[model samples]
Target: MNQHFIRNIEVKKVRHHKNFSIHIDDTYPKHVIFTGKNGSGKTSLLEGVKSFLELFDQYSIPALSEWRDMVRYNEKSLNEADPSNVYLTDQFRNQITFFSDQIDQFCKKVELDIKNAHEIHHLLEEGKFLIAYFNATRTSSMLTPNGVEKVSLTKKYPIQRGAGDVFIKYLVDLKTQAMFARQEGDLDTANRLDEWFSYIEYNLKYIFENDDLTLHFDYKNYNFLILEPNKEPYDLTRLSSGFSSIFSILAELIMRMESSRTNLYDVEGIVIIDEIEAHLHVSLQKKIFKFLTDFFPKVQFIISTHSPFVLSSVNDAIIYDLYEKESYEDFSNYSYEAIVEDFLGVDQYSSIVKDNLTEYENLINKSSSLTQEEEEKVQKISTYLDNAPDAHSNELKLKKSYIDLKRILREDTI
Candidate 1:
């Protein structure tokens, strides 16, 4: 199937990223996983990507033509934004041309002559292209517009579209209708509604690891239930935080796909999973990459994660480290711990322990005998470890090192 994915992306001067780029090719899998520290621009990259796509999808042709001149940067805002390495208002316009060219190429690749804003809008209205962006903020409340919410095709989704609630509401409505039809002895109408929803039920069930698990919506309680073959049913929250997270994510993805007149196997577009491991267990973190890929075979997945456990399934996947500005196509020989400590340059020890160990080791390597100042510092460390009611393991070890270091200053190991 003809499709589209980000072959390369460059965020020259976007939020918190002065210059960040990732080049993808057909050599690796279409799914890309980005990993970084907390303040290391992982979320910022996702924000930038979403911003660009929103621009491409929404901007008119005249707007694109005049985007560069559409903004005036105030001095105060620019100065404030400079500290965060981002823009005041001009950043979005500056990248309009780049995203325009990308969209042009993407259209050509998909065999669509969507050269201008109207053409893109028309194609999107027909559901020829779609985006399934599951933003990190998943706890957003339901939006029941105009006192009614219905399951229908939509070209775009706001960052906070909680399809999980709407999806349940749709099912509850359908079940209610089916119940009324059955009470009226209209078995055909009731059976037809079940047939219409069979595929979705199968999809929801198959995504779970346990095939015996069955999902049911409790219209009275307004919650979902998970029942197994022999065990008693329970609320989905009892499983794991990650389970409900992915369940909601998949719920939205599938709903969007079906509403677009597409399916998981053939929908062609981009998917953004911001902070993929935010609410996931370590085990679930290890499975999400493959699960997403297998579930949506034709879509390009760009997800961000902060967990090292994600390395468990980086198979044929491009791994980008935004903090280090490094990209790896393969780390098959490295353990997840090694990736965290050595490859990613994260020290396992705390700052105090590492610094004290460094000071002690420096004294050991430099001096054959202890100086007065060195002896005083060692005595201090010993006191800190002794009088402390509860001390860290490394601190206790440092206390022992102080004893031996006082005996001989020529020690270089911690």
Candidate 2:
């Protein structure tokens, strides 16, 4: 297994960040999660890392330079007083040297002029590296029936619409090729397709926990189908948003690992996910970290999230809480409420309720007889607590005490 790690990252005058540095390696957790308020440069940092990785390849250096120029210019003042600066340190740059040999070897392969030849070669080329970036907005459409047949015959890979949709299109294309092979008595090619499909199915079932749901390649319509245990088959397009998000990411990862011929245990690469908790329910968010860690133990996952539930999901993860400066806080043992209050800057209890409780306490502790205004204030506080949203058990018990105090005050006044 080829291990790749960014020992440290330094960025200056990029996006909303001025100067920032992050350290990541074996000494730290393999999985790192970034949490911050919106516009705190979380996505910017991810993009910076992506660009840095691209620089490792000779073929991609020019593109990275061009991108830097564009970002620098756009971020500069009208007079161009400040320039955009972004680059990896020599230490981190040296780490990516290990992948260069594999990348060069893959790019040197002889070109094959066959149907879908470009797509196959492209997939193979990408397989040389394990690095992938998953965009938050993913598409779910598959190629139309006529379009699939045309591409299958022409052997041309279609332009990708989105990561998820493109992956499904690849599966459909492979299935079509298998059909063609079967008609021509090419059983070997057909058998290879079957094996790939079975691998995908097994992984999906194992990771997704949908034992009754089976994946099917709809060659006739050129769509992906999911057959439920006791329900009718449905198009992959109709899957729930949360399921679609997770499935698309998993499918892409599995496909990349398979294409690169990387073993499950030896797969080492960086995966950047923006808004990792988007569209996921609380239950799924809590379980997602464990699943990903167990599934890809060697892969380094960098994720940005806003969910407290997601924050509390992992104990060993390196957490970067971005504010004015990056703070590495230990939240491993913090409760959900503590995480929300301290890290997220949100109080577990409502301020209105707290204020009312305070007023009720002060009134009860009075040494002199209650005035008309104080009596009226207590009545309003009681009314407010009665209508307020459900609170903690301790708070509820306190409310009961306030009610008893109100009864005593009324009887004393009478």
Candidate 3:
């Protein structure tokens, strides 16, 4: 079995990040999450990893000049706004030359830290171990590329950014080729193609909790059809944006891995997804990480999301809260409200509820000097708030406020 995952990474001024580093130890879960607000280096971290690994190719470059797009907007002003090649300063030189020296330095460090550079690059090219980053370009449609018939063993290693709709294209090309093989009376070849695609199709059905769902290529209409157990079949285009977002990611990822590795079970490597909860429902957000980790058990998933529901899904997953600069390995016991409050700095309570809670807290502060009737009233309010039905799931946060007042009366402090 071929396996690879990042052990450590360090970078400076790679993108919007001035200094960034991460280390993955053996104790880390197969699934990891990086989460923060917009413009908080989540995307930059993924970009840095992609840049670092792609540089090891030594022969073919990885469109490194795109690093300019990954920088601080004002940093562009640091470059000569010169349209025609005349520029001064290290910043402008870095931009013009695609950060050549920094990339060279980073690649040298990678080669030193993770030796066997030749073997690593070769395995990556063969897709023995995959490393890919996915951003928000998934909703776009895919068109089959010319000359693409069936999966080719020596297919040129693809960089995903060049084609946003790789998954759909993979499906169209493979299924279309299978249909042609069947028409040509090549039963064995057709069956082989179907067999290759069915693994991912079956897993997709499972991930979606749609056991009776079926996928078909509509050659007549040139559409991919989704057939539920009882309903009439519909085009993939009819699916919701949330479905499109997640389905495209899963399809592209597995398809790319399969192009080199025929078995889904043996595929292993890193997959970084930005804004993992993009169009997902709250329930789907909670299940997405667990679903991916469970289905693709060997692959290391490093995902970013703004959803606290995602943060609370898996107990063993590593969550790097970039905004807080904190890492947590166990969070399943945390309440959704507490996760939101502590991780996102979001106040999950309504204004009226917040106002009332604050008032009760202030009243509790007077525990050192409370009249008998006033103390009784404060206790009643606190109890009511504590026992509120909606407060059940929020026991973690509720313990600090209204419930703690009960402790304050006995201990003379809140």
Give the TM-score (vs. native) of candidate 3.
0.69
Off by over 4 Å in 2: 26-29, 57-126, 139-164, 172-211, 217-222, 229-232, 262-266, 324-332, 350-414
Total residue pair clashes for candidate 1: 0
TM-scores for every predicted model = 0.61, 0.63, 0.69
Q: Residue 392 deviation, candidate 3, in Å? A: 3.9
The order of the candidates by TM-score, greatest first, is: 3, 2, 1
Could you tell me which 10 consecutive residues in candidate 2 have the lowest summed lDDT?
A: 152-161
lDDT of each candidate versus the true structure: 0.60, 0.60, 0.64
Clashing pairs in 1: none
lDDT head-to-head 1 vs 3, winner: 3
lDDT of 1 by residue, 1-414 (tens): 433456677666545566445776633335677776667777767766665566445654445445333333333344455555545436644555455564443221122112233444445456555565676765323332232234554655543343454655566567677778989999999998776566556665655556666667676665557777877787644545566678667666655566554324456556788877768877777777777777777667888876677765767677888777788876666666566675555755567755665565565455356689987986776565445433544445665567565545334432
Model 1 has an lDDT value of: 0.60
Say which candidate scores most in lDDT. 3
lDDT of 3 at 355: 65
Instruction: Write one digit per residue (lDDT tens) for candidate 3, span 1-414.
Output: 224555555545644555555555544434668876666777767665666666644432333334434343325655536555344445554564555554464452332123233455667666665656778555635554444444444323444533335555567777877888999999998998899778766876865679888787766555577788778887655667888787666655665566565544456666778888888888788888877776666677778877888888887667887776667787788877777777777777767666667667777666466789878877777766666555565552555455575754668533
For each candidate, C-alpha RMSD in Å?
11.0, 11.4, 8.4
